[model samples]
Target: MKKDYNFGYTKVNSKQKTKLVQNVFSSVAPSYDIMNDLMSLGMHRLWKKRFVEIMDIKENDIILDVGSGSGDIAREILKENLLTNLYLLDLNKEMLFEGKNRLKKEKNIKYFIGNAEKLNFKNNFFDKYTISFCLRNVTEYLLSIKEAYRVLKPGGKYCCLEFSTPKSSLISSTYKIYKSKILPFLGEVIAKDKNAYKYLSESIDLFPSQEELRKNLLDCGFTNVETINLFNGIVAIHTGYKL
Candidate 1:
């Protein structure tokens, strides 16, 4: 039997969830970047900037960036090291095209319309794997993590940046209000799609906690799993390595 997955607050079968998510990204692709800036209050850029820095990209490192929406991470990585080979993958073609257009002048970069749960890459191919602000939206989080593990070369590193649970009660309460109220309001006024943002907000609430995610990486054969919390855990960067 097919398993059910979270489509935000909605429960859906895997296939249903995939199609629904594709539709959502397709609807918002054009305004995705702008909405990201407003939704995170311009902090997402800072997070990605720090994320790429932590990546410590090297010249000629082969990297695969999953769910590479609008190529923000790709842009940052290339800026640090233009010689690195980057492969950007996204389940939604619209989002991939958005990245493609944004990175047209960028060489040594390839784009693929692909699923995270089943990456098209061969085993032990990538020196580094990254996914930012995209994992909670995946239908099968563990499967995708395993896929990230599968594709990385031995000693390769994996990095994931996503919205996370806050450690403080005060920040948690305020963040809840911001996501449930302010996020949808900004989405409606800017992206004209309140429901999509509502779904995104709910997805973050449903995602696993930091410790749980760390255990997941360990179980999937990643060594030295570590997490760096940002904004008191409103967002986090998780890094692991296949050693």
Candidate 2:
């Protein structure tokens, strides 16, 4: 007999983790966008906007948005009018369905139910790859990075936007209070899933620090790795170029 693996926060069986994650997303899929707006006070939009602007996409570019929930980043990418092919990949079918419904009118986009650690894309297929607030939830962080590198064209860019620990001690302390207390309460009220919200908050704490993530990207064969701390280091955008 094998001892069951328990993921912290959820403490769910290893076999059930995927289903639990899917259920969590499915339950929140309808109100996901609204919850994001509320949780971040509409700042996520700005962060994403800035992320797209920094990419400086060109016409006919192929872009992949992994963990693209509700197609928010995909919509922003389409607004650029530069991307001819936009692929939205997520593990949760419900999230992908919501994104598909939201982006039904956009002919340039496609949705795929896929895992980040094992992408179903050809090697060197994309001009740019981006995952906003998605990397932390991936089952295998380093494998995902390696797969991202493997799928990008030569010199292609891989960008990730995620919550990060604040540098300022005072701000960090204050943020912690909100994350541990208020965030779960808000989730219970809005998304009606306090456990999932708690998991999200805890995941941020477990995620790699900025310096460690930068080194991971470099170790995964990414060149020019850099990080941009946002909103007083509460969030960070990490960028790297595949050589």
Candidate 3:
């Protein structure tokens, strides 16, 4: 049977989609964090902080951060001393390598090379699962959400922070120009990977709307799904519980 795949705006063959995404992340891995800060004016940190605050992490909780590029979200969780175990998982080795180097001496963090759509962990293994700016890049968002649901314990929280379209026409238009023009240019100069940044912008524009994503989380077995718009709807944090 010929497998069907969905990549952003178009449908593609399933067998090749993973490789395509892998290539994109690999190309941008070296300067992903730097470019993120540049593109978002360091608001990514504030957005991640909101995610952590809303989760209200507890001590001795095992937290899993999927698509954890450079361990930014994990580091934020660790800083609060609310987590007993922090697992940073990503498909791109380069991204994990950068994270590992940044936290070589940290005892609580463990890096794992794994796909979000096919987590290797046993059921009910994590107290919380969080992803930042990554859900949009996944080839199968619902599958990844299902994986998160499988790994999280009952009553555990699942939070995702991702880019979304702004509601205001004026703001949306201005932001679109910046993303399509300024972001890629800065990414090329800093990351030296123009194509990767181009893909990032394109992916954000092509991703599902906030309401659609909330429904996706519900479809994947999440309960009480809610979305909180940040930065004037330019980004949103979606939270749900496994009941």
Candidate 4:
């Protein structure tokens, strides 16, 4: 039997795990953007800005921003006038809808309500693939990685922005305090859902570290796997080339 994962470090199997994640995001969709600001102290926006700014996108590049919640990354890239063949994909329909609503004015942007593990796209389809702040929720990380690679054109770039463990013990301790106590409190007060925030904080600890993540990308046949850390490794941008 194939293994599936739950956010609480429990084993459930991939299919069930996917359903669980969809439920989670659906529950939090309404307050997703606000919670991001509260949890990251609005640094999430800056982080995305920096992430996209570094991509150096070219004209006519077919880019897919998977797990694109509320279209923040897509909006930033489009606003910069970087590319036109931008596709926004997400597992949670509600989250995708949110992105759609925000990006509707940009009529050229494409949208897909789909799974990351089994991408609903053709092979060698995208020039650049990006998954931001959503991998930790994916039911199968390796499959998602492979799907990103499979959909990319030769020499295409793959980028991921995700939570990671801090390198410094001091910073880790401080972050632990904030995630464990402060985040849940804010979630309860603002989103009226303490458990949702609690799951998110715990999920961070379950996520792979920088080195492990690099190896995973490498194992999926990605080359030049590199990571750029931010906020003392609370999050990182992992980039690789499909060669």
**Which order, best to worst by lDDT?**
1, 4, 3, 2
C-alpha TM-scores of all predictions? 0.98, 0.94, 0.94, 0.96
Candidate topping TM-score:
1
What lDDT tens digits, residue by residue, belong to model 4 across residues 172-239?
99899998999889989998888888888889989999999999999999999999999999999999
- Please write out the lDDT profile of model 3 over residues 68-166, one tens digit for every residue: 988888778877865478899999898889889888888978889999999999999898999998888787778999999999999999999999878
Q: What is the C-alpha RMSD of each candidate to the true structure, in Å?
A: 1.0, 2.0, 1.6, 1.2
**Where's the lowest-lDDT run of ten residues in candidate 1?**
77-86
Kindly list the per-residue Cα lDDT of model 1 for residues 80-185, writing each as its tens digit: 8558889999998899999999899988998898999999889999999999988988888899999999999999999999988899999999999999999889
Clashes of 1: 0
Q: Whole-model lDDT, candidate 4?
A: 0.88
lDDT of 3 at 148: 97
TM-score (C-alpha) between model 4 and the true structure: 0.96
What lDDT does the true structure give each of the candidates? 0.92, 0.86, 0.86, 0.88
Better of 1 and 2 by TM-score: 1
Winner on lDDT between 3 and 4 is 4
Better of 1 and 2 by lDDT: 1
Reference-based lDDT, residue 115, model 2: 92
Candidate 4 residue spans exceeding 4 A from truth: 1-4
